[model samples]
Target chain A: MMKYYFSTEKMSVGYHGQPLIENIEIALDKGEILTLVGPNGAGKSTVLKSIARQLSLIGGTVCLDGKDVEKMSGTQLSQNMAVVLTEKLRTELMTCEDVAASGRYPYTGRFGILSDADRLAVREVMELVRVTDLKDQDFTRISDGQRQRVMLARALCQAPQILILDEPTSYLDVRYKLEFLSLLQELCRKKGLTVIMSLHELEFAARISDKILCLNGKYMERFGSPEEIFTPGYLSHLFSIETGSYDEENGTMELEPAGGEPKVFVIAGGGTGRNVYRRLQRQGIPFVTGILFSNDLDYPVARALAAEVIEAEAFEPITQTCLERAKKRLVECERVICCKDSFGTFDRANEELLAYAKHIKPQLIVQTNFEVIELDQKEQNKSQEQKDHDKFNSVTQKSKVENQNQTHNVRKEGIAPINQKR
Target chain B: MQHRRKMRYTAAFLLLGIGVLAAVALNVCIGTVEIPLADILSSLRGQTIQNERILWDIRLPRTLAALILGGALALAGYLLQTFFHNPIAGPFVLGISSGAKMAVALVMVFLMGRAVRVSSTAMIAAAFLGAMLSMGFVLVMSRKVEQMSMLIVSGVMIGYICSAITELVVTFASDAQIVNLHNWSRGSFSGMTWEQVQVMAGVVAVTSAVVFLLSKPLGAYQLGEAYARNMGVNIRLLRALLVVLSSFLSACIVAFAGPVSFVGIAVPHLVKSLLGTAKPILMIPACFLGGSVFCLFCDLLSRILFAPTELSISTVTAIFGAPVVLWVMIRRRQERTA
Candidate 1:
């Protein structure tokens, strides 16, 4: 058997003696990353807390380096494992250096004074997390992103073989999220630190985790490699997501499409209809898109946002059957939108279809941009009303902008508002 | 930058030391019986003079008691604040002093009823039991209510209850016993003998030294209990040590001087603000000094403010210390909003 560095067997975790998730078994090698991912309140944090020993396990045994974790003393366990919890640190009058140096608690002298070697370790970890410049700044005064980095540095300074974090990237923006996860990857690679953390962002978890555990509040839904866990139709079912769709392969998400019969037909191909499909979706206008190859860059977005997508096989020429289907959708739609600027030999059928649309409908609006075109005079009146509404919105938006400017100027000059001044 | 911080710490310590020396000197020199500096000097040099009885017996013991017991109170306050992670937490605010007062009063009343004399150790033991009882109640309340404000409120309620009980016991005592208990109950450092000073100094010194040794874990504890546990500090043991040490300090103060108000709370906050950091390693000794300085000043004011009539030490401490507590609250509110 391959040697496992950390493992939990038949572990049950909960609060106040009531088990929320039971029989969770996880095994990992020395340098692997295990991520727990689920919806909110799905016991991801509960399991992570139990593994970190922040909470008492309801049942079962957690083993580290072939030793039972419960059997080890707190100091020994702390030397082996370090954790960054979700609870906000309410530290007062502490510098970032002080916060990070606290990780040396187990190694310090009787007075908890940091040694030169301990200081070097703190410096090294702070540098690793790019928080060396913030060493003297108050921990509470830093931005959330910087604070998370400092917390990671604190955990790193523990010099542990295992690291556990609960939603470490929850407060971080996109760039910091990427940086934080990448730093974890580096730690795993360079220091051989085995990381077990719960993550809210499934995309980051998929990209960064070596092993993934799916939780659903009642049980460990699945535990395997990221490739095994992130599959088609699995995440949607796990999260019970009904309002949108998640793309496991590309790690993208799309809002729910407008649900109605196709009122707008988009003749698009070669990644041209991506923006048009999203715009129509945003406007709640049901649309149908066609003549897209299965491997087209815009195919996933169209499939996600369009009421219907007519597609061909990758690298296959447009066929007669696809043209017939497109014609039927075009007839059903009151307007046809051509997103392509030019056509190739493979799109000869789409060209023929466009010609058919122009011949059949005399008032065909051939627009380069994907602006909505009304079919009848009555629809044109509706567009006129929409234009008036847009004009009104613009006036209000301008006034809001001017109000913001006035407030900014007043604040800069340290003056009260006009009404408040009276 | 570290060198600059170290220099600042050194300067602060020097300033506090000087302030303590000045306060002690003023406390000893300025009294109702205005002994000349030359006479005081001779008395110090073992020349038994006209003012010798006043200096050695009255001024010296009272001033020493003020210093030792005041430092003990502040150290106890620091430990309680750290334990609760509440800036306003202190021996008096947390009802610990009142609890000690109640126990000591009960013991005094019971022993005096039987015409029995209580030893200094017996009084300390009684006061310690009372402090532990109140601390236990507060700890249980803290677990039930996660809000620090609620914990403080509950602690104040406990203080009121303990004080009421102590008053009831004092109410039924005979006039002769009440004469001595009355002054001590309202909090005064008067009538402290040299023997009592030695006992209190020994207790306070040993306790403060243990607190200093615990600076490492106490520093970790400032991050909160969960983080302290993760940092390998035994949460249970540290908490237990905090309760015992704080109780011992406050019990000693209550047994000697009787529930002196606000010094326990105010001194630590002032010391922390002056030092510009909350590192327990620095704060433990600084707070002790700050407490000594604060009490010495208050005691001096109490002695000379009304000339012939003396004011209670609690009255002076509340006049000075309550405002600091209010300032702490206001600053904390602003910090939250900011």
Candidate 2:
């Protein structure tokens, strides 16, 4: 039988003897990254703690290299596995080098003094994590990102075959998060290290992980390759994300579209409508976009945010029926926005529709830049003159009062103000 | 950078060693009846001089007691601080010395009442038991309260309780024994005989060696328990060893010289700052030397500042040590906000 590098069989874990997640099964090969993605309080840390032997297992066994971990001595287990926990390391007068050198504990002799070889190992690992410059700085005095790198260096100094991390990127900024994970990927490749960690960033998890485990506090919801687990509807359902849509193919997310009848019609194609669609969505204006090919670059976003979309098959000319539908949508819209700078032969129908829109709503034809024509000459003159400052202040004050009263009315109706404001 | 650090460590150790020798000499030479340096030197050469009895019987034992017990107290504080991961944790602050005091007092009073002499070994054993008891309470309280200040507050409360019980026992002692018990309980290194000095040296030497050997786990432990465990330290074993070793060291001090205040808490902090590093290998030996120097200085002050009518050792220690504790608290607060 082929041997798996690490596996858990019927493992159950929790605090104080009550199992919160049970019957967990995992298998991994060398040089693989396994990420646990789940809602908060979903037992990700508990599972990690059990495997690290920081917490007692409620049931079953975790095997490393076909040997049950429960049977190994602490020193043996430590020599094979290292962990970077979420707990803050608060030390007194400890240089970063001292902190990293402590990872040589299992290899040192009786007094725990480091030999020349051990010192070399510490130096190499610090270099690996790019923390050599911070060697003499106090561990407690460094930034969180620098401290995380030092901690990872400390873990690497253990020279373990398997590394476990608990939310290693929780406190890091965007740059450090990407750097830290990329470093992990490099270690996994160069050293054939098996990595198991829990990540809150679903996109990073999907991109970097060989396998993903979904946990829901009581049980394992799913476990498989990211491709199998990150299906379109699955991630949103798993996270109970009711207010946003998650795109599985690209691993991108979008907020829920504005709810109401289409107030604006966007005549866009070839990715030109994406920004306008998002801008209108941010402004809480429902919009209809039409005459977009099925394979248009902006199709996914338009599908996610637009209230109505008129789409034709990929590489096909705009159908007469689809053009009629777009013309009908254009009539219902108070304004038509044309995002196309130019049209090809296949989009002749879109050009015709644009002309129809100009004929029907002559003043409403705005280009993709979204600059509207000034229809009222007197209103435009009053806004353009600097002498209208007092008039602007009075109007702003009236609107502020009206908004306060509206919020008060909503509160009185017992609906939460957060939802109303959004 | 490495060479500079090595030089710093070497300089610190040399300075501390010189300081300890100076303090020892000053302690042995200056007293109510000061001896000349020449006479002191001759007496050390085994000559029978006019000040031989005074030097051999009183000054020598008391000086050695201060040095040995002082080192024990500081090492105990270092171990406790590492175990708790709190800078202010020590024998006195954690009530361990008071616990040992209570236990030794009970044994002394009980043995005296029964017309039996208590051996030094029995006294140390009883004191060790008491120290462990107080340590147990502190551990439980630490588990319940994560705040370092709260743990210290609870330890202070435990100290008060143990002191009150000891006071009640002392109040009922016979008149003949009251003076000795009172002087000991007030915390003094006076009346230390050569035999008692020998016993204390042996205890301190063995215990300090064990602490030195434990530098590895102690260093690992300084990062906090989770990382220490990841580094292959057996948490349970290390924790139990810490409790027992710290208790033993503090118990030896209480058994020999009573419950001296602040030496356990202040000397380690002073030593760590002086060295500018908390690496346990250097810190363990440095704290021992620092503690000896500190106690010798305080004991000398107690003996000569109010000559012939000596102050209790605790009074001298509190005068010099309490301010360090306050400074540590202020620095900790600043560190938190920063």
Candidate 3:
């Protein structure tokens, strides 16, 4: 039988008489998969090493099964808890069977001769980790993932009640990552090994961990079920990124750009519009791309994905023929998104096209500096650049402009729309 | 499984064969009156031979003495390294060699010049006694210092103190006694007799058997002290037994050849590199052969390098030993960083 509960008082740890991390209080129960999720240098590994008695606690006590952990001998501590460190073991020339047999250290007597019972225990644990077939091979020659499984097998040979792992999935690929988690889950469910691990992936931890310990600055920022700790506000604070929103029904966070969706009317050329097209499709926003010559990379991506495109002739300038089609499409769209290179040059005919859009004043969402369009005589004649740059300089000034000149109902999430400016 | 066992057997036989051939060649070739191999072989076959004095008196005793000392020092190095889990640890790490040198210095410089004229055998016994006494002090101190590095440092301090005492004693010695002491410090097997060989071989053979039986526990020790204890090994008993065994081995070799430096440190490392492991079963015999082979080669170099007026064997060994140690240290650092 294993004793699970300890005091909730925080503990302090140090190495070689110098303090490392402190004020960390945690309570672990049997049959629980608790994960410590933090970025590098957040001291997640320090906490685990302190619990396993691999490192000394400088100030506070670590009571295991209601007794001071420091008082117990190595054999006793090893029997209660096993540790899997991140070191790539260089103990080659030993077979897998030999490596696992070392876990019976506390049980064997002075001569190190194995008893029948010890041999049986080693075999059973080898089978448990499903590494029995690779038992005969030299440990070094095996793949890293297989070697990790072998290490887990050795830990199980100790028959430890608590298994502590540090970055167990760090070297694994996507497929192995899922399989490893499932294996740990099965072990926790069936054998009641109190599993504690650290992870880098947020999605994997949210899916598998029973309790998540989110470490940020010095203390744990949040410690609870994954649903409570993985909200938009908490994630935004943790990662310090701009876009963070959660979908309660899907149990996933939606990280879209600030100011909801821009009602973009994309004026893309060649296949420059493909990425924006798929991004809008996944985001479930309205958009249009085109004036694509017949054989542009963007034209096929837009066409194949059922995006409405205004097609034009291959290698042709933005003539009146293509402009008439684009003008017709631009009226229905709320904004115009153009790639910087859509127009061939500063031709007089393309200059007329820019004048027409300036007259309507749609929200033009372009990827690059549209010098051909911005430097057109028609846009300069309107003097829109100075007003546009000045109006976006401050939220207070933009809001005043938006309130005074409310001609469009664009419903932008956090920005002043083009038509709303006087 | 049978093939592995067979290969091990073949290796053991090969080591023994090479040891015997080298022992005969080195014994025959190196002496003031260099006996030919044919005459040496004939004398052994009980045929009346020329150069009988050279074959029996001068060469035979010295070569046998070298073999015994070489094998014992190597075995001692093997046991100490395995027990400590540190590749560089040696029997001399406990300062036993310095202690023995101190005792020999006291006998030659202080006692022998006065009314007490100690025999060579008595001086050998005195050196052996001094080494055991130092080992006893280290054993007592090891109980207090829980850390391995601290214990090693304590041993180093003991060596330093003992060397200081020896140097102080040397300041008052007569010139003849000083010359003898200088020769002893250089670690030679030149004037050894069959009587000394008879004494050393008995002690070495018995201790080797004991170390062979203790190999399994020593293997567990290479993992670590805590790991060895968890494996049900009695750490206290094994540590005491290993100390006594290695001390006896070191004492016996120092008694015969006067504390040859490199064999006790380098032989075990050479064996481990060859076997690519720390397992004692393979390491023990490999160390035994490698030690003998290394010492014999050093002995040969000492005689030939400066020929008729031979340089000390210790000088030759140090010339070779220092560089090898540096290389191993550099390689270990590279391994750790890698």
Candidate 4:
């Protein structure tokens, strides 16, 4: 049996003696990352707060380095663990450096004055977080991303063995979110720091966390390595997703599939039909897509957005039955959209399917690829003429508001907004 | 940048020190009986001067009480501000001083009715009880109301109620008792005996020293309660200590000089602004010195401004301090809107 570096055995956490989540058994090694992922109001924060000793655990014991957390003095706990919480720090005219320097509280002597070593540790952590330039900036005045970084630096300045963060990435924008997680991963690796944090972003949790803990209504739904926890259909089951589908492998959620009977047939393969699938999904027009091999790049996307996906086995010949099924589905649709242009070895099935559709109903083909250049040129010429007319002080024929209303109507009608005029 | 911050702190302290020295000198010399500066110096050198009676007996004890009580009031205000995380929180504004005043008034009336002499200790003890009662009410209200303005409005309401009760107690007193009660209720630094000064000195000295020792946890607590607890600071204990210390300081002020208006809120705020930081180690001392300077000058103006007919110290302090409070509120509103 592996001896855990830190673990919670049958832990229960809640507010005011009412347990929201119970029997949370978590085990972690020295330098691993554990992330709690759940829907809103899933008590992710309550668990983190409990582990940080901000909230009393309702049941069970949290052992850190073989010592029970409740038995450790506050100073001992603080010296070993530090927390970054979602609650905004209410500061008064404190510089970023001053805020970060406050992490020395456990180490500082009387009056909480920073010694030379304490100052050095603060500086090192600030530098590690790339916030040395922001040392003199007011903590309140900084951007949210920088503020989170400064808070992380403050926590790191504690030189803690275990770091607990409560939804630390909630305030960051996309770029900062990636950067923050990457920095956290780096810290865990380099410092052997055990980390536990709650994150709403499942993609980051899946990618960054060594172990993933899933939480829902009143229990720990599952806890395991990310590989075990992020299995297919688990998230949708855990979150009770009704509309949109989530691909556990991709760690991404897709728009709900267009409902009702199929109207459009998308001849999709080799990543070509990805855009049209999403466009059709957004248009809420039920679509039937494929004749894609199971291993095809667009297979999963087609399965997500289409009402029915006609299929083929991976690395196998295009069967006569598969092409016949595609032909039947193709003819039943009002229009056929083939996204691929040139045919190749694997493109034989799509080419055959397109040919069969053309023979049965030529008007349904709606070929857009070849004429796109001419359409773009025509639109640009029209715009040039308008500009020249304006230069000559000529008034437009239509009111601007009427034109704007028409554009909005086109958007509402779900016409493709970009590069699809043909 | 660090060097400049240190220099700014040094300069701010120097300015406060010089202002205190100047205010004390002016208060000592420029009284109704103008003994020249040299005569005052010689009097300090043990030679009796032309107005030794006015300087030593009248002005000296009163000035000392003002200095000590003023410092205590501002320190009390700083602690309350830190507790609430609102710069406007103070003893006078939060009705803490009024509560102390009410209790002191009731005790004085009952004692004087029996022809019993009220010692400074008894007055301070009574004031502490009253201050803690008001503080407890404010603490309860603070939990219910999230808005800072609502807290202040409720505190103002509490102050009015306490002030009314104090006045009612004074009204029931006899005419001879009424004179002393009136001056005390009006809030002044008058009629100070050396014995009373010694008592206040002892209480304020020990309390301020305890407060200074708590500057470490107080620093962490300023960031808010959760972070303070995470920092190994016992948040509940620190909060309790803050309430007790600040109430004791304000109770001492109320016991000796009654409720001097606005110094509790205004002085700490001005000092924090002047120093360009809110580090508790720096703010605690600076607020004390700032309050001393502010009260000394305000006390001096109260005496020499009206001369024979003395303006109460609260009136003088209000004239100066109320605008600072207004300025703070306006700035807060601007920041919110911006």
Candidate 5:
């Protein structure tokens, strides 16, 4: 068997006379992917930075391969270890390949030129990251997810025995998040590199990491596996939330909403209707919407999407036929909401549609105000009448501004609070 | 691979072509007589003695001075940029130039007192001493501060205090001595002799070579001080050595050309943009070549933009350089948003 590598003792790290993380001991055999999981501000990054020598230890020794880290010269240390940071790479104008090639700097000559071996290492890592095609692209111009992979390639090119990363998944979308963690996992296994990383995603950390280190509630919680660390008891206390369920298989925490449900009926036109429709669905509540102009984006979106909606006019005002159909549905809806008018003007039938919801005593959410409703009334009566753009602007735009602020009020009714994880 | 190598060769040839053209333009178009290029060429061929005194004795030296100063400042800027990982950083960020100016200032105020008598070599030596002294302080501070931002703040502090000291020195200088000091400080190549140009060229040439050799290590610096060390770079020693070499380059130029601005700060950015990469291997040469071209262009502009009365080289660079810097800032902001 290859000789094992381990951090010899419990070491505390501090900066400027204050300890960041203390009495923490971690050891790894070759090929172990150690994941540090914690809530925000848990000093996971400090631990990595300290071991990578980005930060000096306030106390204790960090021995790598049985050698004291502090005793090695910079070049010697670099030869032994590498780090990838959560912070975005700040450089501009370099190609992906160029950035990766910089990893060979420590191994190169006095002038730091790359040898053939250095070039090979850079190319190999680029291929490994599936970014061989992106090698020529400007690093700064690339997408955030691509940039993160490029950073990994750069780190790998250094060929360090130990690799440290801080929150590699923090900025990634879900798909990219899974992909990045998987890539890291692959790197550790294939290279037999001792990998250490800090991450915020609990489920992914639990699923992929070989060992999990939890920094939370002012204590270092070490677990041999993700199952041991991601318990409901551990997570609820960690986040200081009243109710949270840890989905062990998927590694997601389901939060209990703060307030009771709000009864909402939506009157929507165009696509302005989708957000409210989904919020209601996630809240486990029901809603009714209608007199949707058939050409409206919201009509199709709601039909194809969730929630019960009644349609009236395809290209014209809501007819009596559409309203009658919607009224039958409205018998069940507790409140009515109109997404802000796509066009300010409404037909006479839409006015009656609004009046029907008003008569039913359901809370009315109007996308527009009464002037457009009045113009539609005249159209229904076959009267020659006109309204200025300004009249429509005031009628349609003003109430909607008030309606936006009302969304906050609805949140207090606790339909669905804004998701803060993203 | 062969085709790419050929294309790179072609590109290099084009850059050299531009550099040579700019050199000639700056040469024939500057000085009191403002000799024509044809006359300059003829004089080189030994056909124009009437203009030889102006061309060979004055204009030639000035042109060479511009080339040396430009190349040196640009390389210094590139080194400092990579060293700090701050694009705004330059040779002057650590008050290296001001420190050099202070040394010259002290020499003038005390040793050469109103005489305007010191040789070009002595002034260069004094400036070198001053720049090196300030760089010494920065190197010490870099060892103490783990963060580059803090190190930059310390440099700014050093620069500010040095400027104050220079102001005090100026307050007591005689008018004639002040005139010499002001002209030197604002940057001028007017009276540069072959001897002075040779000295400046030697320093720039040697230092550029040293820096070019160190380009790979410097590239590692872009990843960061920590990462660089992890890769087996003796970062502490390399950083100190590079700082010293860069300070030496900047100081020699200051001694010869006065502290010409922007060439050290702006040229590296322009070169990086033009080359389309920040790979130090290419960037160092690009900076050197581009710096010389840029400064020579500024020198030419200073002479011709307003005929008879010349502007300072630093002033001309500021006029051109500020826009590039503003564009960089705006580009960075837009990038952050996206």
Candidate 6:
């Protein structure tokens, strides 16, 4: 409803006169990045393609700077907007430089010949995206990450008022993905270049986008800032994620937790129990882990992978009632595993819970970095003087219980002694 | 890299220009009555040399016809290639020429039977209609099958059907009419008149100029329809222009020379490789020159190869062009796999 640099007014788009998604309202001001996020086949691309005028709009209008997009002449529209498409750019005998130079199409002469200024613009954009070294290479010969950068360079050289991209980071590696997005963010901030794109990587999308549009069936389901759009249970519902859970605030995904538990109780606090919880999940051990504070670093992972997470309120001290509840859960477990060897003032509750597990004495293990400590209670109680520390040196503190039965093949310095590199 | 490309463009143009001059001279001089270059020049200056009539009336007209028609065919091929985004699309391959040939054959038969004369304009109109008909089928097939090879297969099928129909029409003609239709149907450059040469030159000149003006948009189109549209190319309008301009050029060629084969497909591919770029600004003129050179050589070869019995222009062109087509296909497959 608010006027912006680019806006779609009740636009309906589809194939063969059918409306796949209708009444889509999106408004982006200058120097903004709007990202579309949705499950596959939810018509994210259709909405994007329609916005770029690559697909004819089925109904309503798209406005660029208060001008009806469909009514603008080719030159008028092209100078204002450019798109990086998902379609494979099938080209022959074209260098990366040539592809980049083609971004000047709207400003070029009658024959699309680039003048010195246009050539300089191309070079500048290629440099801006750090693909200057690849300018002379054949576009199709480069790696996909390099190709994505080159494509970005091409779109940038257009000097458009609005840039539209579809899954721009889909082909990029992690390093380039961050670099590419930061470059776009820089353009938006420094040059006031507005960008609208779809991103499959929700993490990057959450970090980079100024506004996010959530799409599901039939329409734009939710549209707002990333803070508003990435609320709890939304992406799981939107993506129809049945087996796994998504951490909305952080945009991290976790596989479904093992069910029907009570074999192991893990006393984990701070960030120590994350790996142990995941390891137990992978082994299908169905462990219950907690007395984790709601704001603890491992609470989310425990919530995702643990059978039961005995949670405490954030910043709260160890209360007698919560400890009693934890003790009750630990009694039903066959064995107790403590992921941390030491607990400080903040995690003193975890230390107290670990002591209680040993006092009850069902079966207990103290977990450390790649080490699991097992106490044989009868032998230790019988000869505390002789067993002096239950501390016989066995060389490597092997977590053999976690290992699936393998004979030690060590010769010297733990090498199996293969002859050749091949 | 830019300077190297500039050098390649200059070299390609020079090469094509020299080839065109050599082929023209060879075609003009090495006919059945071997006219020397000096005598041919003198004949052009109205000196009335002994072999002047043969040089002027038969050799010169035929040579010019081959040059003009060849260029038109190649330019048409370039336009169609741009339109379809397929390197293999061309007038002859897509059955457009054969379609035109059929219409011309029908007109020739009906007019000759009625004891009436057919003007070059009337022949061109008929050819244009038939070309559009075949192009319609090709366009429909292109929409139905997104695969590039399937489009070519459908075009080739359309060509076969049109050729069959043309042959059927030729069978009903009188014995005298049969000889004329038979020679034209085989695709020859013989019996071309100066009037016919002038008309084709006029048509090709106008269409090629229009195509040259369209070079900027056509360059955008090379990236694909979506990008082209994003770049503010009026895709529908550009596509329509390519179809009309290409069909007109092919119509002009078929009206005069009766469906010369393979020059359309081969010349544009050859020129693009030579220039090392598909930038339409350079490609348009280069394709025209390359087509002229290709056709001139083929036309000249058709005359001298069998001596007293002249070969069809299609036969000589097919001998060279088909291999290039096969090479393009093989290379396309390799690139796709890679």
DockQ of each: 0.64, 0.68, 0.15, 0.71, 0.36, 0.74
Candidate 4 lDDT tens digits, A1-422: 98899999999999999999999999999999999998889889999999999999999999998999978887888899999998888887889999999888999999888889998999999999999999999898889999999999989888899999999999899999999999999999899999999998899999999999998969999999999998989999988889999989887678898676676687778887777788777656778988898888888888888899998998888898998898888877756667766677876988888877666666553343542211123333554555566564434434323333442332344334422542
- Model 1: TM-score for chain B: 0.98
lDDT (Cα, tens digit) per residue for candidate 4, span B26-87: 88777788768898889889997787788888888988888888898899999999989887
Query: How does each model score on TM-score?
Result: 0.91, 0.91, 0.62, 0.93, 0.70, 0.91
Model 6 lDDT per residue over B225-278, tens place: 888887888888998988899999998989888888889888898898899988
The true-versus-predicted C-alpha distance at residue B277 of model 1, in Å, is: 1.9
Highest TM-score scorer: 4
Clashing pairs in 4: none
Candidate 1 lDDT over A1-422, as tens digits, reads 77689999999999999999999999999999999999999998888878878789999999999999877788888788888988887688889998988888888878878889999999999998889999999998899899998998888888899999999999898998888899899989998999999998988889899999999989999999989998888999999989979988778899999885666788887777777677667666677888788888999899889888899988878789988998887876656777776789888888887888776763444333333233555534544554566576888556445533442332233122221332
Docking class of 4: medium
Candidate 2, which segments miss by more than 4 Å at Cα? A363-422
State fnat for each of the candidate structures. Answer: 0.67, 0.67, 0.14, 0.70, 0.74, 0.88
DockQ of 1: 0.64
Q: Which structure is stronger by lDDT: 2 or 3? A: 2
- Lowest lDDT 10-mer window, candidate 3 chain B? B223-232
The numbered model that scores best in DockQ is 6
lDDT of 3 by residue, A1-422 (tens): 54555433477766785766667666667778888887678778877777666666776777755877667776687787776777554352577877787777567765556689998999898888888998878776677788778878877888887788888888988887887888889999999878888887777888888888877646667778888877645665665545444333234444343232224556565445556555554544555556666677675555544235667666666567767877776655444555434355623343344456656653332223322222234433333444566665688566535532331222231112221221
Q: What shift in Å separates residue B326 of candidate 1 from its native position after superposition?
A: 2.5
Clashing residue pairs found in predicted model 6: none
- lDDT (10s digit) by residue, model 6, range A217-272: 57889999999989998899889999979999877878888676356788887887
* Candidate 5 ranges beyond 4 A from true positions: A1-3, A63-76, A115-117, A217-219, A227-232, A237-252, A256-422, B1-10, B21-56, B91-99, B114-122, B128-172, B301-309
